[model samples]
Target: MQQSKFPKYIFDWFGGLVLLIGYIIGSVIVGFVGVAGKFIFRLDFMQKPWFLMLSNAIVFCLVIAAFDFLIVRPKTGKKLNFNFSPTNFYTYLLIFPMMLGMMFIGEFFTAQIPTTGPFFGDYYEFFENLMSGLTDDPVLMVITAVIMAPIFEEIIFRGIIQKGLMNKGVEPWKAILFSSLLFGLIHGNPWQFVGATLLGGVLGLVYYKTKSLLLPMLLHGFNNLCSTLLVTYTKNESFAQAFKIPEWEILIIGIVLFSLFCYLFMKKNKVHYSDI
Candidate 1:
């Protein structure tokens, strides 16, 4: 990897600030669409979760495109070149356990956090209500949460932000950490943040190593789909309750799976891209 003479590309604070502005712009765009929809079609879609997600996807695409084409192109004379290279399909399949493991561990640890405080309690309620709505429409949930969400989220977090930082000379570890922090904060809930950040770090590292977005996207989609199914069927995101196992047992299983993922990730196999 060649290092640039520049200051590793802040892009005006680079990580969280870019996400905040994109989200604010997305919200404003969605608000306008909602108002127009209400006046013209007598329907307000702003309150719908799927519409909000769609708007965010659109905004993220535009923001990154502008950065790549208008700014980065002129400054660096190169596009960000977001990597979505193909990798071993078998290796890709194995990302499932990692997602499941993280989910179990996430739920176990988050269960310990107090959700009774005025702020946390309300946030929990709000998050629950938002997720619970997925149950009412399974197709919509699969499309928005599982498919579109992962694609756009990975494109921004790993593809754009993390890769952008690295291209500008940021160390890989620091880029992953910064991108992971922003990824966690985007969840807007501390309970989800812990797992999201950790998982984000894993995904970021994988993206950097393999130069493939497909694996991370698949892992992210699988994670969100499982959470969605858990919420839809069990009305909660607890792996213990969903699996009919004790929390401790679930936690141990999670530890084992996560450990296995670590082993497999580091163990170079015959697959050309396995340890690339």
Candidate 2:
């Protein structure tokens, strides 16, 4: 990789600032829409919370994309070249165990994790209510949770922020790790942050290795879909009551397989892209 001449911290700070501004703007827009919808339509979103959430997500993505393309890109002098290659499927299979490992870590820390900003009980209740509303329409839930969130989130984080960090002379691993941590923190709950950050790191590695944002986006989508399916399945009495097999042995086997796959993938891919 070619070394960047600019001071990396400058870009990191700037990127974080941009993200903060974008989020504040996006959240304000969502609040406006929610208020407008309730006043005009006389519906409080219990009827179609999926639509409400999807509307918010879509607006947020568009705001970020526009900011990235119109303002950020012009400032940085770069074009949005989205590379969504299909050859990176195997990479995600390798990411599965890494995600599971993070879940285990989250479980371990669940007890010790201090509640910040909000009490644990209230936060969980809020999350449950939000999720229940989102899940009321399974199709829309899948669309929002699995497809839209992954695509937009990956585009913003891995493609924009990570790339920005690399452009400013930061090392790839540091950029990836910090970006992942930011990714987790943005989720607004520490419990989810543990797994989200770990998964974010894995996604970062995928983007670094392939130099393709699409790969990480797809993997993220799959991860979200798997979680959605697990939640959906567990909601069913028959499925929940079914004899659940303890997957410790399978998890162990998965660790070995994932390790081997990571080794092979890294070993086979040697060419690195020049930093933007």
Candidate 3:
């Protein structure tokens, strides 16, 4: 293992902090740029699909690069693993459905909680607006959400933050749990929080075991792709009502199938990291 430049405590804490700071700074930069563009060019920058998508991609890339240089590079002497293998490809096929099923389970539980009145309603509306971009620019949305997002997110959360914690002698579960929690928190809403946390835990475990970032990236991409497709193709009421038939029965069946897939995943791929 390569030695970190900072002390163990500093390295560990900074591992978590860098991403948070990066996101805040990235958002600020993007906001300022958008405002300036609107004024100087006399263009409605936000309404331009290509500009919005390109700006988002640029901001995400800059955040990743900042985290890499400021936090990851100073600590680790080597680059984070991005290697791929046939095993990773095969594992992704199994884990993608498992992760989606887990998210559905999370969604079911989330639905049971009574909203805190208007606040929750406002929050949901805000989230809906964010997603509305998909309808306006399906191609750009797909490229950003389904492709760039997974790569950027996986590199930050799994490849850098979680792996950095482990390198500093943190236990695997602690690293995975904390990183996963941060992953969910970054989504910035209660609805995504539950699902992202559960999914993050699974992805963290996969990275820890396989020691490759590729698998988690693939899984993340697939999850986002499925979500994009579902929302883009289905009307809100139609989609909700489509799942209304025997909801409990379907949930039960989904749970059982998810369990079976998880079992098979563990049985078939016995890759474990002693370091973690």
lDDT scores for all predictions? Answer: 0.74, 0.66, 0.71
**Which candidate number would show the highest lDDT if scored against the true structure?**
1
Cα-lDDT of candidate 1: 0.74
lDDT of 3 by residue, 1-276 (tens): 864333222236665576567777877887887799889988777777777777767777777776667764566554334444435456666776677667566666556544557788778888878877766677887888889888888877887778778877889999899889989998988887877898898889778877767788888887787677766776441223356655455456558757877777878876643322
Find the 10 residues in a row with the least total lDDT in model 1: 3-12
Q: Which should have the higher TM-score, number 2 or number 3?
A: 3
lDDT of candidate 2 over 179-239, digit per residue (tens): 8998898787866787688778878987887777777887788778866776786762121
Instruction: Give residue 246's lDDT in candidate 1 (0 to 100).
Output: 90
- TM-scores for all predictions: 0.84, 0.78, 0.84
User: Candidate 3 regions off by >4 Å?
Assistant: 1-11, 79-81, 88-93, 113-116, 237-244, 271-276
**Candidate No. with top TM-score:** 1
lDDT value for model 2: 0.66
How far off is residue 182 in model 1, in Å? 0.8
